[model samples]
Target chain A: MKTIEEINQKIKDGNAVVVTAAEMTRIVRETGAKEAAKEVDVVTTGTFGAMCSSGAFLNFGHSDPPIKMAHTYINGVEAYSGLAAVDAYLGATQPHRDPKIGIKYGGAHLLEDLVRGKEVELVAEAYGTDCYPLQNIHTHFKLEDLNQAIMINPRNSYQNYAAATNSSEETLYTYLGTLLPKMGNVTYSSAGELSPLLNDPYFKTMGLGTRIFLCGAQGYILGEGTQHNTEVERENGVPVGSAGTLMLKGDLKKMDPEYLRGATMPEYGPTLYVGAGVPIPILNEEIAQHTGISDQDIGCRIMDYGVPRRSRPAILETNYHQLRSGSVEIDGTKIQTSPMSSYRKALQVAEELKNWIEKGEFFLTRPVELIPSHGQTVKPLQIKRPSILVKDLKTKAIITATAQDNLSDVARLMVDNNINHLPVIDKEGKLMGIVTSWDIAQAVAKEVQELTHIMTKKVIVAMEDEPVEVIARRIDKYEISGVPIVDRDNLVKGMITAEDLSRLVCSRDDKRGESL
Target chain B: MKAWLNFSPEIVNKAVISNLMKNFDVSFNIMNANITPKGGKMLIEISGEEAQEGINYLENQGVHLTPVKRVVKKDNDKCVDCGACLSLCPVEAITIDEEWKVELDDQKCIGCGFCTSSCPTKAIKLAD
Candidate 1:
């Protein structure tokens, strides 16, 4: 087995054979992993996709009179300025303060403009201080004008990510790109086999301080990225969905605008499209095997965005081979597929990295510490506040009726309580059915005297401990205005009307308004 | 020539399109259509020897025709070849080439403007 030092010596001697991940796939397929490992010195991998967790740290040199800037804005988007004066962190997804400009232009756009060497307006605000008296500073600057502009992305290069599909009636505008209605199309954001993390599945050659191609500039892996999970299920040594991620840091001044672009998806805010590549030194046969994995071997889950929840239901499991083929079958319908990530740019990144290695301008580095292969998992945010339940609703007393009761009497009871619906109950207070004002009017028109003839036999209901959100969904789904809260024995505990639920919402909103 | 034909409520369900093809010696291609039994509009390109005769016949049937040229324009400089507009294109007018560059086929585009909105950079737009 060869070491990184041996690979570095080969590069310096101009004898190192560096092949792209795509080329390495063919080499290993023909010459086996062991032979390929001996033949290839390094396997360069690349991926270009919209990485939202990317940002830049800029030190816009201190203004005249040395203003202690507490608030800073680049272009129209606000940047985090909680640090020292003149320093701010501009996140890619941060939107402009103006609602009209929200998502259309953002920090990503400003970053792109900076890389393109375009002039951007810088605005800072602060309270007048003794040491730094200037309260406000408005200026213009270019990339070269900044004292230090560093790209420190908390997450980039996901190993694999879920493919998106919309199963709803209306089109969904999401960060995954536009998902057309009724599974109209599927969109996935990954370079698949050419992706950096997929080629080095277990983070073998990649870790803290590992050198990488970050948006046309040399960068280092800071550590495990935020939400980097290694506990995901794997197939053919690659994680099925989004698993491993890398925290990357690079000099923004050295980045190329072509490799770093700003994209504003309709309705979804702006995100930075990053071109990144990692060179995997083929030190052993295992590394070669991992690099040799093809698009067909890599699998990802197809998630339905129609669910409108954090854990969207998986429609099916699909591989990049099926996805890249322009169409995939979901629920027996042939659907057109599109890649949100750019494969062409990804290939360019790979080719560029290969050239760098061959020209001996870039070298492989051993990781100071390996990224954790286990114990890391995605943990959802948990709030300690109590959720509103149907039982918790201080609903009005549940009015009841029996089959023997006269329809006019029940109608009178509804009129007296100013209620539209009344739950029909049995002798033991168990709910039998329900009747609404419309049913009473129908009974009058049909000349029906008995409540049995007018009352509905099937009643939609909610459980006592069920979350109010669930009951609200049922009310919306069934086109009803209310539901009877029932126990396990079908005993009517209370009634939750649309009015009651709306009041609850207003109260919660009032509390929020107070805090605001 | 490319022309948009508007069918009124009275003539919407009539066999005007079929009759035009059967009676005329001209060749026509239906580029786009949004029709119901009540009324609708259709974009079609008509050509061949009796094209003028077919236009006269359509006019006689109270069909309003508006000559259409290019419907959509794509600014190549602003496009990133991201393929966001590929799947949303109903007519398959937009495609990713072997190099993954986005290619727009004007001949196939019905000017639906589906790709215009999906483009993040606003690179593609419908002609006014």
Candidate 2:
């Protein structure tokens, strides 16, 4: 086992440590919110699907939180419209002569066709021939069209009607099982009476599961019988109904089973998860009520606080995968509530979740024991132990320049040791000042010019035991490139440079033979 | 044989201009195109060149120019006595109330993007 001093030295020596997403998540979960917040430099959210249950283990701190909800929109009308447009384009082109040409659709239908080799392709020319006059249409045909095919159009209006009705009813399932139950309590009413033929048992028989949960919050209920609009124009006049209906009715959850099968499971079983959309409104309201601040102000504050914290090194390394995925594990299970699969989405979710947690709508808790995806490997580089403590690298060094110790001697010492700087020590071994090649060059330049130049009379020295980050920050902030490291006893140990700090984080991928 | 007209000035000028336009998007009216007698040879002259001129032109001009610079401006009508710029000014040159709008101390200004990027209405310009 290495001593703490040895470990510190190893870290100082620029040794790379490999950490797994699972291990990071576990640490965060164990540390709780405050500790995790401190441990985490950043948090990310909106890690849809399989990644939802894994984020809480990034770090012990809640530096970044997840925000953003993932939901699927099902739009049959849009699908039909898209199919109609494709058919129209194909009919006009009719590039392929082969009648047996294959036509493909979205992933859901692709999987279905993969199982059943026969698939349907609706042609607009045929529809036009059957429903409208062909002479009025000047059909421009292009050869070798890939999207053309032949199939019976399943224009069963009753099927669409049944689906539309069933969707509205099934929405209660999503609302009750997913959203309402999470919100705690709420009242619900529908203008369309519940079908007597449809009961809990009927739904169960249909594999819809039991609707055991209800919204806990107190809220008003409104329901009205409304005409179904196949097309409705907005103020912009682009027709909003199709897009709206598609978004509200599209079924993504049912289509992603194959993806789910490919998903890597967590160490523990299933757990509850919340979506960003569901929690954000509540969080915003709570924050507004609690702090008496405007929502915009709250948003700006959260964004300002969240981005910087997340940018920290430790937090970034900890929540790499969670930042990739927006969802977090609640209890032990992964619950994906977002549709996004991008890193930016995950970050957005994390920021929103941080705001929500701050507002106290829901408390973040430990969920699972994260297992390491990547095994640990020992780093090879070795770092020399510091002899003196230093607070910052920006300060000027105190050196005692003796008559015997001329510029040549200092230059020789620096060149021989491959060092740029050397702090001159007194007879008692106490640091008096420092010297560098640049200092010698300046002195030489002044001597050559025969100009009276005042050398630096005041000297600044750094304490040796300061954190490397602090030293680096001061060096960068003050535009100083190098500084002397000193101990609590004011003895000069070694010098650090901006180059060293840069090299510490820099890594070259040996396998790829490229720097990352 | 006249050695003075050995090189076609038009071809050279066109080639140089084409090359310059390829690398940079520049907007400038050609102020003058003149021929000067140097060492008994005709030399082409092109002027009124902005920052985005092509490589050959810039090389011939021999002036170091940054293509991108921050934009700064002050609208006196929108000036409120909010002392936000005083503390937020990285160079500590911006004062409140005396001029109302942001005042730049040329010596102190380091041409950093902080003040220009942070300004809500974009009243600061790091002029090229």
Candidate 3:
């Protein structure tokens, strides 16, 4: 078997045989792991997903009178100024403190903007100290001007995660995405077979200080992530759920902003989309075999986020193969699924890492400390949704069509609103009819019929205080897509549809055992 | 030709679309509209022999027109099938297929530029 040193030598000599986790799987399957292990020098793995515990430490060169900045805020996000002068750590999920700023543009944006070489406003406050006398300072610093900007993320590289679905009657706005009402859809966030941690589930050669591909540059594992747990169950070498994690650190100057970005989820706060890559040296047949695991072999539970809990009951157990297929069966019902992690980016990371290794621009390092097998009674975080009557859900400005309006115009209104339901009202704004997507489709197909002919005259409308569940049931039972919310006078005030119901669910859908 | 129609509050009650259909040989499809008492915007596509005349008539009839030369485009290579860009779509232009993979309908999109920012991978872009 080839050792890491041998592999490095091969890499240095441009004779190394490196393959992605995807390719490694195929090789091992063609020839047993034992046979493939002797031929393969490195198995590269990668993951690009939201990593909240991620942050970067920046050392802005000391200003005129070096302020031992007791407090620091970059773009209104509190940075860890507790360290030495001008040195601070900005956490990924740190909220934006500026009054006009949004959660979408916070600490992660600060990191990204720094990497992009944009000017960032820096604010600091320091109580007059003996050595440092400056009390307050405000200035702009760019990445090129900074002495050292390093990314020191404490936790990342979740081995596996759960599939997230919404089961509640109301729509949920969550990190998993908009979970449609009544088990409408499922969304999972995992790099799957291409994921670094999933490929080397047991962290064999991936330990402390293991050289890795971070963002666009080479990085290393600093230590076991803060929540690193090895007590979890494993099938072969892969963790069933979330298990081991890596404490990663990298140079911000060397990272790529394309692989590292900041995002703002509608209801959720700011988060960093991290692109991480790990290389597993083919030290032995076991390590090679571990990298050979395919998506079909990786197991993840489809957990319902409808229940507001850390660990919700699983709807079904599924593999990445089924997940990658884009749909999975739950209770015999087909549900659409989407990944939160960008497989395209993950694959790019793996390919980039492979190229670097081949070009001898990067090398692998043996782990100083490997993670233990994991354990956790972890649960997928449920996004809390207060089930209220239709009245509580504020409807946007009601856009209606006239009874005499042409069928094409009715369809046009629906298209503009990106809604299927269109309330046909009188000149005084009294609801006379409602047009559903089916009605619009019929209108489009037939090339005939006015709004009066296509609209459902016997409208299924809801009262303001009507429970959302009732509307949902009616929409389902009647097979109608939506119901217009009306007043006691029967004047249309707002409308709700199947699409509206789908936007009501909520959850974190974060990595680690909670969601795979 | 495609143009965004801005109708003022006073013109909201007019049957301009019907008038255009009856007067011109052009056939039109509404991509999106948000007509209200306060005024509204409409993204529409018109095609036929009288397309230019129809656009001129709409403009002369108090309907301001801004020809849309480009729309939002999505890159298949950069897309990860993540649903992050799904909820931000106003026109339901972005939809999840049976497999939960996100599929974008370029025609339905109003090019509002919301999905571009929401996209974590920066796969969606506005292009001519």
Specify the highest-DockQ model's number. 1
**What is the C-alpha DockQ of each candidate?**
0.58, 0.02, 0.18
Once fitted onto the true fold, the runs of candidate 2 whose alpha carbons sit more than 4 angstroms away are A1-405, A415-418, A424-433, A448-481, A487-493, A497-516, B1-84, B89-121, B125-128
Better of 1 and 2 by TM-score: 1
The lDDT for every candidate, in the order shown, is: 0.90, 0.28, 0.80
The TM-score of chain B in candidate 1 is: 0.75
Between candidates 1 and 2, the one scoring higher on lDDT is 1
Q: What would the per-residue lDDT of candidate 3 be over residues A1-516, giving only the tens digit for each residue?
A: 667788888999999998998889899999999998888988889888888889988888877787998889888888978888888889988877775776757888788888888888889999878788889999988888888888998988777877788887766667666676788777787888888887777666777779999989889898778767777877756777777777998999988887898765545677788999889888888887888889899888888887664558888988888877757887788776667777767878888999999999998777777765445334544536445678987677788888888776767777887887788899888999988878788877987677788778888788887667767877897787788889988899988877777665332123233755
Question: Measured by TM-score, how close is model 3 to the native structure?
Answer: 0.72
lDDT of 3 by residue, B8-117 (tens): 99899999999999999998998768899888988889999999999989988899898877567778755655566654455567776764457878667777776776
Off by over 4 Å in 1: A386-501, A506-516, B4-42, B47-49, B56-69
How much is the lDDT of residue B125 in candidate 2? 56
- Please write out the lDDT profile of model 1 over residues A127-200, one tens digit for every residue: 97888899998989999999999999999998899999998776889988899999999999889889998998
Report model 1's chain A TM-score. Answer: 0.82
